[model samples]
Target: MTLGRSAGGVRLQDVADLAGVSMKTVSNVVHDYEHVSEAMRDKVQAAIDALGYRPNLTARRLATGKTGMIALAIPEIDQFYFAELGRHIGEEAARYGYRILVEQTLNDVEAERAVIRDRDEGLVDGVIFQPARIDTLEIARLRPGTPLVLLGEAARPVNTDHVMIDNTRAARDGVEMLLGRGRRRIAFLATVHGDITESTHLRLLGYQEALLAAGVGLDAHLVLQSEGFGFEDGVRAISSAIAAGVEFDAVLCRDDLFAMAALRGLEIAGRRVPEDVAVLGWDDTAVARYSTPALSSVSPDKQALASAAFALLEDRMQGYDGSGRHEIVAHSIIERATT
Candidate 1:
């Protein structure tokens, strides 16, 4: 049967009439109300599709006081790990009929604060923030009543939701893999020069724990510090360590970029990977699979992290006012030729 449209185009009433349901049912389906039955949702959806009905986002936002948009603020989208995580978040958000507005803070304190401020200004319904330089106190001060979910290794406010893998455990697992492969003189890379971030501190602790467990003495010289977490930073660290006559049979990197760069640096120094020096990286990004001698990596469940973030954020958006919830996603070691 042909469905007639109102002068303002396809309306909720038209879909309701076509589906033989109340307008409330059609509205609930369009708004993704969780209490609606699957059969009713399907029926309303069919009518909506048949009538080519499109939601008026402005009207909906004015009526419901929600924009159906969420901000995903990260340090840098250029980084493989963050980029991959963003992809998972976008996909998961779509499942809930929400759009993601990504903001890159570039690890800048002001930039991170600006994203939170924008969220408070009603540009989006909520925010999923992966902070790099900002602290929990600052975030709490800025966020106020806004719905926010924290990601990454930054300190989580007691009143905010958080989702991440156990960084210390993942780091230890990667180092233990190297130790089991008979790599005694293992070097821990990715130490920064200035103030230590919580992530670096936890990962470094894990590395130390693994060495201690294997009866290997901690070598302060082997804990290499870099200016940044970049390709050149890894190369520079390796070159400096070698020049200083630091002896290490294996390397545990903070990320794939460092691990890949170390491969190049080792090749230049006439060292064979996994033979002369085994290497392990974090975040099993796509590059790890195709890298020469495929890098062994600590792979965090990105999809799970995204799912958990959204679940927590959804609760907050739905007016669940309570203390923060912290979620730890699973992680694993993807061993390959590098180890």
Candidate 2:
């Protein structure tokens, strides 16, 4: 069909004609299918730009039954972690010839189910999920062909790709580094969530491993839990712990914002950073480096994780039978002024 021309509208045929390639070749380029010559890709892209031949995504879904969008099921991005993940995921999806539809669960199970519902309703082609609930019963109803990828622990369904950090080692390494710097009394910091969330559970596991290695008995008295991950929330957590007469020579937080909060709180509590008590945190965010005394932290590369999630999910969408894949990005300690 002619469909329509430029300054008005253009059809897929126009793109094919201008590029001197078959309609199937144009389709392959649009879908980013490999084996298309670079010359063909260049010609098709130029034609797409020149002819203003925007593929009607809705119409394409009706014709092919494929939504050219990816759904990202994330917990609320009020903190840096998910925000950064979202940014990188969107960029990665763009590279894979897909768009992103973001859904936030606020850590609510019902909300998470709703995200799945929206996906089943043709809202997206696949899902990259950071699940707050790892229980089997919850994901039992996930629609087949949804091409889901899991991040963090309790990765379920057993038939999808997953990417996770070594949460235990991240914590263990953070603590031992502090001890190595002559800070003996160390504590792990994290925002306490309901027992279901793996983030809190795994980070604590890693932190405890380090304490055991250092011959420091795990002190429940020194564990400081926050209700949130904001910088101010971190400050409040540490401040309250100190006011209650808790004694610790070092604070290891689950994230950079929390680490900075610990530093701020410690200063207010009349402690000198690295001088009196060193502080370390997971997630080497930019703020970690720019803090008053550059915060030492674990470089989790959340952006890289997000990028990988979308890339693999897109592969599944394209009919690749890669099997239920799992990937773990290596992490390193970012030593700074704090420890």
Candidate 3:
């Protein structure tokens, strides 16, 4: 029997009939119920493909009281690390039959609070937040019972799930790589004025730790502070350091964008990469691989981070009432042409 594309097109019952299975079985397959056999799933999926069947998401949401949508809030989507991480998180969310609704918080406190507020309104099933400005206490106060997975180097709330790499250890390894190459005059870049963020504090601590271990005193002048964490911020910071007669044979940046900018700034200052100034970056973003002389970087396992964060969020969504579970994903240094 041929199914015609009419008023509502193909239905679930139509797909079941075509697959020679009960409607319940088709429903199970559509919902990705684990108890369904692979053979039955394949049969139902084949019929679904043949008829171009689409599940009624509105009806499902109404029946289950879940929107099957996840909210991902980040400081900036344009930043290389966050952008790459979002892509990975999106792919991981799809594996669980969910779509992502991204909210760019831009490190604004109000914007970050809005994401938690929206989740309370039942707009999305849960939230994956990477907060930059707000602290853990405020997040805990705002999200009393919402399913939240905190990302990045922010202090994790007491009872909220969190996922991140060990920033201090990763930074130490990156700097140690430079030290192993006989680079003593290393400049730690990407410091900001005022209250330091957790990420910057940890990375800088690691930088100092490595220098101290090598018996090299941390020079106050070699630590270049930036106005912000943007590409231009890096460029200006490095250029100003050069113009001000800062002497350094190596530079370790907080992120890939800064490292790439340092490359340009150094070139403008007539310093050859590796030969005159070795540069290292964090995040190991795609740009790191293609930058001039390539960027040696600290590579965090982004896929593992997404997987762990989603797993925690999924557990929370499924009524897991345990305390906050903090997961530390793996990271390593990628020594490229720059070092």
Candidate 4:
């Protein structure tokens, strides 16, 4: 006999009956038990699809004490980099039957603190955080009573898992590549220049290291600071340098957006690329390849970063009480017309 809870309501028993399995077996399949045989799982899944069964999340969480939801906090969702990161993380979480709640911190310290101090407990199983302006000391003091995975170089070696690329090394390699093209007077176009963040600091260190290694004198004038990380900022930085008679044969922009802008600015100034000045950028975003003159960039392993972050968060949720984990994904340079 088929058990019916109410009209148009499908219960667990319905699935079990459809799959010709016991209720316990249906529950095992629903909960993703590892020991379930492949054939059995397939049969149960087929039954579920036929019946369109969906477990009640509230009941599941109440019984399991897990919300099956994680929060992803980044600076902004509109920005291409963060948007791409969010999409990857959301897809990854979905693979494990979890959902990701995305939040924008706007790179503000107070906003980041608010996210850390979220009052709703168990609303999310954990957090994958990318802090922009919050200091490490402040982050160390927060009582975020949940699992956390740090997504970038900031807030490192904290009481959480960290996934990142070697910013310093990548930056150094970018400069070295420019140097190899016989470009000595390389300008560093950076965002957040005066109050440097961890990423900016590391990239600058790498730039200086490359210069010193190549026996090139570091010209203070060659380092241009910008208030923003955008095309206009790149244009302004390069244009201002030109107006000031600051001689430079190349530019190492902090990101692809800036590099594309620098290219336009250089073109407007009647400078030829490769022949007169070469440009390099980091992040190797999609737009880099299609820019007017394809931009050379530092391509970090973004897929690896997302995978590692999800793994760390899952381990934490599974009650792994080990010390903080730090994983650095690899990066490489993509050569193009600019350099």
lDDT of 4 by residue, 1-339 (tens): 123221347888898999999988988888899999999999999998998887777766766788778999998898766777788888889998898888898888888988778725678988999998876677767856788888877787557688999999999999998888889999988655555368878888999999999999999998887767767877887888898999999988878888888888898899999679898988888788888788898888777888899999899889997878889999999999988
Clashes of 2: 0
The alpha-carbon lDDT assigned to residue 95 of candidate 4 equals 91
lDDT of each: 0.87, 0.77, 0.87, 0.84
lDDT of 3 at 101: 93
> Model 3, 1-339: lDDT tens per residue?
222222357887898889999988987887788999898899999999998887776666765788789999998898888999999999999998899999998778789778786666777888898988888898888764668899988758878889999998888898888999999999988797663468988999999999999899989999998988778888999999999999999999988988998998999999999999999998999999887687899999999999999999999999998889988999989989998
Q: Which ranges of candidate 3 are over 4 A from the true structure?
A: 1-8, 194-196
> How would you encode candidate 1's per-residue C-alpha lDDT over 1-339 as one tens digit per residue?
112333348877878889999988888888788999999889889998898887777777776998889999998898899999999999999998899999998778899888777665787898999988888898888765679899988868888899989999998898888888888999988797774368888889999998898899999999998988779988999878988899899999888998998898898889998889999988999999998889999999999999999999999998999999999999999999998
Provide TM-scores for the models.
0.91, 0.88, 0.94, 0.93
What clash pairs does model 4 have? none
Give the distance in Å from residue 5's predicted Cα in candidate 4 to where it truly belongs.
Answer: 8.2
Output the TM-score of candidate 1.
0.91
Query: Which candidate number maximizes TM-score?
Result: 3
Of candidates 4 and 3, the better by lDDT: 3
The local distance difference test score of model 1 is 0.87
Q: Order candidates by TM-score, high to low.
A: 3, 4, 1, 2
